[model samples]
Target: MLTVALPKGALLKDSIRLLQSVGLDFSAFLDSGNRQLQIQDPTQTAQGLLVRAQDVPVYVEYGQAQLGIVGFDVLQEKKPQVAQFADLGFGHCRMSVAVPSQSPYRSAMELPPNCRVASKFVHCAHDFFSKIDLPVEIIPLYGSVELGPITGMSEAIVDLVSTGRTLKENGLIELDCLYDSTARLIAHPLSYRLNQYNLEHWLNEISKNSQPLAAKAS
Candidate 1:
């Protein structure tokens, strides 16, 4: 049976919805009290593995899972051996560099050499700063990165920003956007080669249904 890895959290519901649209049902895993990590979807001849978003690509790249749904942010950091099949287009956000609203550093380039920035995504932060020729000290923070700038722990932060409410509440403002991120469908290259027919069919089905929703004009 085919095995798929799915991120466990806010993206889970949307991931399941997309899979269900392509005839894979994982409603059982959605129950509040359901703690099953592996769920069998008999109707679709597949199994689902619930995993952390950061670990999804690892599972797929190692051939443990034939496919996975994960964020672009994780992919940028990991760069695992997987074929990025389709952009699921949901879970939209931006990876950005943010600083305290009151700071004199208005842009990423305005920072003095060797300034510090905090983030859970250390690799991403490093790459972004390097591209702009900004020498930075990367302080890795697991959570509440917004506080990095507010509390003077770091000069800025590189993190995922959706609504900007968190930054506003923490007295921070985005200095520069690193990348636009969304959930993507990825497959192990070997698995795709081994199960070409089935994998191709699945990819086509998902791509067909995953088109961006049209904007309603005012």
Candidate 2:
């Protein structure tokens, strides 16, 4: 069976919808009482694995799943060896460098060397600063990065911003955006190259159904 790794948070609803459009229903993951992490489509043609967004690529890369739907940010952070099939395009956000509104630094480049930058996405944060030739300590904080700046633990934070509401509420402001993020369909490299489970056909169907939606989103 073709197994898919579906992210378990904000992107889950749209991911399920996209799969539904391609005639694979995984909406049982949405039911309040459905606690099962693994589920089969009505036809049993495929199965869906509910996992953390960060684990989507892991499952696909290891062949535990032949396909997955995850955010671009997680892919950027993890840099998993998976074939990026399509931009499913529902979860839209940006990876940004933010600081206290009153902070002297206005841009990522302006932060002093050795200064602290907190983030759950340490890899993304480190890469962004490195490409800019800025040397700083990337402190990994998996929860509420905004507090990094507010509490003086760090001068800035690297995190995802949707409407910027969380940043505003915390008296933080965006200085630079590393990149915009959206959900993307990924596949195991070998599975994709080998055409496992007739993956190519489903990929084509998904791409056809997905392109118009992605275009609309763009």
Candidate 3:
């Protein structure tokens, strides 16, 4: 059976909706009382695995799932060896450098070299700094990265910003936007190449029913 890895948070509903448009319904994952991490589509053509957004690529790369849905940010941070197929176009957000509102630094470059920048997306943070030729310490903060700057533990934070509500509430200001992120379709290369379990047919159906890559979906 073709197994799909579905992200568990904000993107869940949209992902299920996208799959439904292509004739696979995994909406059971969205039920308020549903507890099963793994659910088979009612049609018996495929199954879904509910997992953290960050782990979607991991499952696909390892062949535990032949296909997955995850945010572009997670793919950049994890860099798992999966074939990136399409951007599902929901979950709009951006990865940004943020600092305390009163901080002297106005941009990522203004921060002193080697200053501590906290984030859960350390890899993405590191690459951004490296591209700009800035040297800084990337602190890995799994929970509440805004605290890094708030508590004076770090000079800034590299994290996702959606609508800027959280940043505004915390008195943090965006210094620079690293990149925008959205949900994307990823597939295991081998499974995709072999078209196992009629995977190509499903993908074709999805492609026809959904927007093409890089096109935003409502």
Q: Measure candidate 3: CA RMSD.
A: 1.6
Superposed Cα deviation of residue 13, candidate 2 (Å): 0.3
Evaluate residue 92 in candidate 1 and report its C-alpha lDDT on the 0 to 100 scale.
83
* lDDT of each candidate versus the true structure: 0.87, 0.94, 0.90
lDDT of each residue in 60-148, candidate 3, tens digit only: 99999999989999999989999988767788899999999998999898999999999999999999999999999999988999999
Give one digit per residue, the lDDT tens place, for model 2 in 1-218. 99999999999998899899999999999999998999999999999999999999999999999999999999999999999988887899999999999989888889999999999999999999999999999999989999998889999999999999999999999999999999998999899889999999988888788887888988
Candidate 1 stretches with Cα past 4 Å from truth are 212-218
Better of 2 and 3 by TM-score: 2
Clash totals, every prediction: 0, 0, 0
Model 1 clashing residue pairs (backbone): none
So what's the TM-score on candidate 3? 0.95
Using Cα atoms with residue i matched to residue i, what is each candidate's TM-score against the true structure? 0.95, 0.98, 0.95
lDDT of predicted model 1? 0.87
Q: Kindly indicate the candidate among 1 and 2 with the higher lDDT.
A: 2
Candidate 3, run of 10 with poorest lDDT: 209-218
